[model samples]
Target: MVEFTYVVSSIIFGSLFGMMAIGLTLTYITTKVPNFAYGSFVTVGLYTSYSLYRFEAITPYLSAPIAFGIGGLTSILMYLGILRPLARRGSPLVSLMIATLAIDIAFVGIFGTYANYLRYTYVFIDSLNFTEILGDFSIFGSQGLILAAPLTLALITIGLYLLLTRTKFGVAMRASVENPSLARVLGIDVEKVYVFAWFLAGGLAAMSGSYYTLYSQGGIATGSGLIVEIFAASVLGGLSSLYGAAIGGVIIGAGENLLTGGGISVFGNGVLDYQKGIPLVLMILTLLVFPQGLASLPWIRVVTRIRRISGRLLGGIRRLSARGLRRC
Candidate 1:
């Protein structure tokens, strides 16, 4: 039963990790720059949840929308006020990535200051480094997040798929992603598409952060700590593919949780401290072994060969069955 709980927890955590990473992947696809401030958006969402709970005493469920809105608005502002201007002036991808880092640092400082203010003035939270203010609640003999995280991930994945495949705005966004100059020539407002993509990315990151508060300790360093894991997941998944990001997040999540939750049985208690390094190790390994990601692994050719063989065997079996039936 304990081991089972670990599996469930890992799955939920992985789902949330994926949720945060998809936005990073999206921004990378559209702008060709990884937004290092992406995790800061998650930090904003975490604080948004904290503020809502402190002021209104509401559950995270109620605060999610507000968190998402604030996150999206902040992301849009970052793009329009900073990134857009720099990009227009022909800033390189490295410069844009550096700008995101600056944004992350500035945001972290602001978050820390706000946390201190709340602690000093309202006495709401005792420590910005760690807080278990709203402890986890259960549902159906499992943690509420066991249900919420997977459901949220599924909905977001499906919604994004539908939006990208079915909607006009989504089509325009896809066009912009593929070729901004051509999209513009075709009368697509590439800048607007970029803005909307950033909004969605920010909103998703924030929503993931809100869920993170339910399971982990909330603090100023929360986002900073998570950024490494988020990047690991993104890089593992094939940085250019959103679905790959989701898969990468789940893999890292499960590995991290599985190790931390049950490593004492397998490798003894000393492994706990090493748990934080799991994602970093995975990131390095992924880069070394499959720099193009699992999606582009060389074994894909072998798999395709096996699939074709199986397909031919199935067709042969059907043909033999039909021949026997005709003979009968």
Candidate 2:
């Protein structure tokens, strides 16, 4: 029973984390910048929702967009108004990284200074029934968010994949990621692509944050250390692949929950609170084993990429072959 509860809890939380991580993965994939401020974006999102909630004029679902938009707009403003301009002036990568960190600090200060700020409480929905993976296992209300958020994430993932592969804008974004200089030569608006990436990242992150508030009645900076957790999941998912990051978030959530549930005498048999270290440990282990990530494994992700690329290359060759055959 104990094991069943732990595993169930892990899966629910893990999936939710994955949803929260999608934008982080996207931003990192395109920008090649680990944007430590990503968590702050989440903070922006939650506060955005909370702000609307205060007015008694909005519902949770509606407030979600309000939060998401605030985070997204802030990101757009930063990229268009600040970061892009600085980088255009020939700023180094290290400088850019530091600038992002500084922005986060300033953002947090602003959040703290607010008179009636968003505070996502850790405890909410004390009990709720959910689709259990096993027998008769129940979950907390927050656990429901764990499930719902990931479903939203899956939709977002499909949407993003379409944007990256099917849409012209997505291709341009991918081209920018591959080589911004070359992409610019090919007539891609590299600046716009980057700005779009920032907005998307911030907007999605905010959705996650607001969703977090729904799970926990948040009014404080519950997102302070979120970057580290996101980073660890990103490492697990595959630093270079968005899909990998999402997967990593799920695994991190599950593993941490399972490990801490055992009360294995770590931190003097502390209850699940020590689960916080699971992501860190999984991160170190993952880096040591599959530095490219689980998504890079032959059985799942890497092989598929190889096949897709191969199919495209061979299709062109086959077309030429048929043309020559007809001419001959």
Winning model by TM-score: 1
**lDDT per residue (tens digit) for residues 2-63 in model 2:** 46567666765576567656777777776666687778888786666655555463544567
Q: How close to the true structure is residue 320 of candidate 2, measured as C-alpha lDDT?
A: 96
**Residue 255, candidate 1: how far off, in angstroms?**
1.8
Q: Candidate 1 — which residues are off by over 4 angstroms?
A: 133-137, 298-328
* Per-residue alpha-carbon lDDT of candidate 1 for residues 54-151, written as tens digits (9 for 90 to 100): 77887777788888999999999998999889999999988998999999999989999999999899886554765644655788887788888989
Cα TM-score of candidate 1: 0.88
Which portions of model 2 show Cα errors greater than 4 Å?
Answer: 1-12, 116-146, 217-219, 262-271, 300-328
TM-score of predicted structure 2:
0.76
